[model samples]
Target: MKKALRRYWQTDFWREFFDTFLNISDCQNQPNLSHWGRKISVLLKEDPSRLRETCRLLRIQDETILQAPSF
Candidate 1:
């Protein structure tokens, strides 16, 4: 599942969407942080509104982290 999500996240659509989202949300500044804590803090601090907006746009439901369903 994790591997499949990594694959999906590497796809053009997801990559482009992520890039555009970060650009618009001003998250491009902290690209080096590989940890979720830093990423979440940046999201919640820098642009919480945009974070929420992007989350909605990405269709991330509550209490969920995206994972590709097994075949």
Candidate 2:
């Protein structure tokens, strides 16, 4: 049961991230897959610590969500 909950949490987390990235890229007018790919690469290159922080926050969020009573 816990594993399934975590899996669902992970899926939702990534989906939200994808939506946010797409929105921030502002490429709805002229979408370019390659450009988006390059942007992600640049983001990682600029500061990997941000990625670590994101992961840390995700862990905390997962714990909080899991502790809540299921409806």
Candidate 3:
């Protein structure tokens, strides 16, 4: 979770979202499989292009997680 959060923070798009008052609580209320999908959907409602950028950023984040060493 920490690593994922870190990778999420590393993205410019996510940084903007964080700065724009988007909170983890928004995701906390969502279902597991739909958390990200829902969050992106909400963001898209606000700004459609941002959704695409956020998705790309998240994909990079996911890749980072896959490449990270396990303890």
Count of backbone clashes for each model? 0, 0, 0
Clashing pairs in model 2?
Answer: none
Please, what are the lDDT tens digits per residue for candidate 1 over residues 1-71?
11222334326645654775577646555544356456556645676775665566556543245464546
Clashing residue pairs in candidate 1 are: none
| TM-score for all models, in order of appearance | 0.28, 0.41, 0.43
TM-score leader: 3
Global lDDT scores for all candidate models: 0.52, 0.61, 0.61
**Using alpha carbons, what is the TM-score of model 2?**
0.41
Alpha-carbon RMSD of each model: 11.4, 10.6, 8.2
Cα-based RMSD of candidate 3: 8.2
**Candidate 1: segments with Cα more than 4 A from true spot:** 1-37, 60-71
- Residue range 1-71, candidate 2, lDDT tens digits: 22222334346645755776567655455446687677656665677875666567778778888998999
Name model 2 segments beyond 4 Å from true: 1-42
